[model samples]
Target: MNLNPDQVSNYVTKYADVLVDYSLKLVSAFIILFVGIYAIRLINRIITKVMVQRNLDPTLTKFLSDILIWALRILLFVTFISKLGIETSSFVAILGAMGLAVGLSLQGSLSNFAGGMLIIVFKPFKVGDTIEAQGVIATVSEIQIFVTKMITGNNQTVFVPNGSLSNGTIINYSMQGERKADLTFSISYDSDIKKAKEVLLEVLTKNPKVLKKPAPEVFVKNLTAASIDFAVRPWATNANYGSVVSDTLENCKVALDEAGISIQPYTIQK
Candidate 1:
C-alpha cells in the first residue's frame, strides 16, 4: 500500500529512538565491564600481597585468590548483562548447574585440595620432613594444594596427591630428633657369642655419631638352623641414621673378622 509520508517518518523516528537507547546501554555496559575487570585485578593483587605478608600457605592463598577473582568477575559480567535489560534468573540458574557439574567432574581434585587443607591445618607433616607415605619414602620438598612434592634418597622427585597422603599412614622419620639403627649379623654356631658382643660394643663406642645418652647394646636376636644372629642397636641423630648404620655394620664385620670370630653367612634353604 502507498503509505502516508508523515506515518513513515513517525515509524522511522520511533525505531531510531529504540536504537539510540540500546546503543547507550551497550556503551555503558562496556565501560562497566572494563572498570569491573580492573577492580577485580586490583583486589586480587591486594589479597596476594596481604597473604604474602602474613606468611600464609602458598597453595591455599593462590587457590582462594583465584576463586575470589573468578567469582567477582562473574558477578560483574552478570551485572553488565542486566544493564541491557535481559533476564538473569535463567542465566544464574544455568551458572549454578554448571558449577554443580564442575564440582562433580572435579571430585578427585577437590578431594586432594581438601586433603591438603587438612594436612596444613592438622600438622601431620611439613616440608623438609622425611616421610614414608603410600609405599614411597622421601623428604617432603613442597606442599601444594593438590599434591605434595618429595625427593627420595635416590634423588628422584615424586609428586603424591594430597588425597591419599591425608587418608593413608605417614611415617615421619625426621619428626623425632633421634632414631635407632638395628643391625643384625650372623655368626657360626660355634662362635663365641660373648666375644662377638664385645666386638659390637667396641664398634658402637668408637663411632662418634652414636649417641651416648641412650647408649648402644648388642644381643642375640635369633638362632636359626645354621647360625646365631646378633642384634646391634645404636641410637643416633636422624641426620646421621643412614651413614651411621652403614658405618656400624662395616665396623662390626671387620671387628669380628679381626677378632678371629667365625662369621657364618645365612644360607637360604631350598
Candidate 2:
C-alpha cells in the first residue's frame, strides 16, 4: 500500500482547487447579499418618495413599501443560494408549500387586507366622514389594514372588518358636502294648510344654517285622523346639518303657535 509522489501531488492539487472554488463562492454570495440589501433600501426610498409626491395615504405607502422590500429580499436570498451551487429548486418548493399553507389558514385576514387596499385605492370614505354601513351610522375615526375604526353617535367605538365593509353597501354622508334634513310636522286637521305651510317655510328660511340656493320647501305630506302632516325639507352643509334640523323644528313650533296654528303629534319618518 505505497502511494507515489505524483499520485499524492494530484490529490493535493484537486483538493486545493475545490477549496478555492468554495471560497470564491462564499465571497461572491456575501457581496451580493450586501449589495442586494442596499438596492432594496434605495428602491424603497424611491417608492416612498413617489407615493408621497402623489399624496398617497401614509399608512398605505409604508405597507406597500415594506411588502416590496421583503419580496426583493426573498429574491435576493434565492439568488445567493443559487450562486453557492446549492440545490435551490427544493428550497423554493419548500417556500411555496409554506406560503400556500399560511395563505389558506389566513383567508379572512388576507381578504380583509385586500379589501383595505381597495378601500384606500378607491377612497369610498375617509377619516371624519359620517358613514352608514353594516347597520351602523358612525363617523370614521381611522382606517387600517384589517378594520375600520368608527365612533358611533352614542360614543361607542366600533371596529368593522374591512372585508365586509368593502363588500357591503356604504352610505357616505359627507361625500356630497351637503345633506337634506327631512322633517315632518303635524297640526290639527282643522289648521289652515296654507298658513301652516307659510309658517314652516318661514322657519326654514330664517335659519342661517340652512342653505339658501336649493331653498326650503314645505308641503302637505299626509293626512290622518289625528293631524295633518307637513313635510319640511331643507338643505344644509354637512357641518350644519344637525343644528339646522334642530333649530328649524324649534322655530317652526314657535312660529306656528304665534300664527294661531294648532300643532299635533305625529311620527317623523327619517
Candidate 3:
C-alpha cells in the first residue's frame, strides 16, 4: 500500500526524535567517561602517594595504582552506559565474550603478567641482584609488567618471562654479604698431603681479600679412582668472588709447582 505524504513526514519526524535522543545520550556518556577517567587518575595518584608514605615497594605501588584506576574507569563507563538507557546486561555480555577471546589469545602473556605481579608483591628478588633463574645466570636489570630484564655475565641483556621465572628456582647470590668459594683440585696420590696444605695456607695468608675471621679451609676432601681431591674453601665478599677464585687458582698452581707437586688428570677413553 502507498503511504500518504503527511503520514510519511510524521514517520520521519518520529525516527528523527529517536536518533536525536540516542545522540544526546551518547554525548552525555562520552562526557561522563572523560571526566570519570580524569577523576580516576587523580584518585590513583593519591593512592600511590599513600602507598609511598607507607613504605610500599615502588613497583608494587605502581602496579596497584594502575589496576585501581583501570577498575574505576571500567566501573564508570558501565555506569555511564547504564545512565544512557542502554541494556547494560548485553554490554557486559559482549565485554565478557571479547575479554575471553583476548585472554585466550594472550594466555602466556597474561600468565607472565600475573606472575610479575606476584613477584613484585612478594619480592623474591629485586633489580640489581645477581640471580640464577630458569637456567639463566644474570644480574637483574629491570622488573617489568610481564618480563624481567637481566644482564648476563658476558654483558648480554636477556628478557625472561615472569611466569617461567616465578615457577622455577631462583638463586639470589646477593642476599648474603659473604659467599664461599669452594675450589676443588686433584693431585697424584704420591703427593705430600701435608705439604700441599701448608702451601695453600701460605697462599691464603698472603691474600688480603680473603676473610680472616672465617679463615680458609684446606683439607683432603676425597679419594677418587685416579687422584686425591683437595678442597680449598674460602670466604670472600660476593663482589670479589671471581677475582678470588682466579687468583687463588693461579697462585695455588704456582706454589704447588714450586713445591714439586703435580696435578693429576682424569682421562677418558674413547
Candidate 4:
C-alpha cells in the first residue's frame, strides 16, 4: 500500500498511542500483582496468628491458611488480568465450573473432610483415647483429615471414616477420666443374699484400683429359677478398669467360697 508522508505519520502516531496505552496497563497490572501478593501474605499471617490464639489444631490451621491463600491468589490473578484489559469473566466462569465438577466427584471425600474438621475443632476424642464407635473398640492412634487410625486390643489397626464416625455415637471411655465396670455375679438361690452382697462389696472396697469417691456398689439385679444375680459396679480410672473388674471378680468368688456361699453358673432357660 502506498501512502503520503502525512498519512504515514498519522498511522505511526496511532500505533504509538496504542503501544503506550498497553504498556501502561501492563505496568499497572504488574504493580497490582506484586501488591496483591504482599497483601495475601499479610492476610495469611494474620489468619494464622488468630488460629494460633484460639488454640486451633495445627494441621487444620495450616490447611485453612493455605486454602485461603490460594483462593486470594486466584482472585488477585483475575483482578490483574482484568486491569491489563483482558476479559476475566469467562475465565472465572470456567474456574467455577471446574471447581463444581471436582466437588461433585469428591462428594464423599468432602463430607469426610468436613467431618474431620468438626472432629478437630470440637475434639470428640484425641490421640491415645480409648473409644467405642461403629462396633469397634480401639485406642485412637492418629487423627487425620479423612479417617481416624485406631489400634485394637489385639494389636490390629483399623481406620474409621470420619464421616460416619462424626455422625455416629462415640463412647469416649477416657473423657470423664474414669470408667465403671459393670459385672454380674450369679449365686445359688439357697445362698444368703445379704452375705453375698457383703462379700462382693468387701471385694470391691479392698481393691486399691477402684475409686473410693464413687464407692463400689453391689445390688440384687434379678432372681431366676437357677440363681440370684448380683449387679457389681465399680468405678475406677480408665487405666485400672480392666484390672479392677478382673480382681474384684476373683476376690468375690474366693470370699463367697470362704463364707460358705455357693456361686453357680447361670444357664438360659428356654
TM-score of 4: 0.76
Task: For each candidate, give its TM-score against the true structure.
Answer: 0.73, 0.85, 0.77, 0.76
lDDT of 1 by residue, 206-241 (tens): 999999989898899898898898888899998998
Give every collision pair in model 1.
none
lDDT of 3 by residue, 144-207 (tens): 9999999999999999999999988999988887778888878898899899889988898799
From the highest lDDT down, the ranking of the candidates is: 2, 4, 1, 3
Ordering by TM-score: 2, 3, 4, 1
| Tens digit of per-residue lDDT, candidate 4, span 1-270 | 878999999999999999999999999999999999999999999999999999886767876897899889888988999999988889889988999999999999999988888998888998889999999999999888899999999999999999999999999988899888888889987889998899889988888899998888899989888889998889999899878877877888799899999898633220
- Model 2 clashing-pair count: 0
Output the better candidate (1/2) by TM-score: 2
lDDT agreement of model 1 with the native: 0.88
- Per-residue error for 31 in candidate 1, Å, reads 3.2
Q: Write down the RMSD of candidate 3 (Cα, Å).
A: 4.9
Q: Report every candidate's CA lDDT.
A: 0.88, 0.91, 0.87, 0.89
Model 2: residues >4 Å from true position, as ranges?
A: 1-20, 57-60
Residue pairs clashing, model 3? none
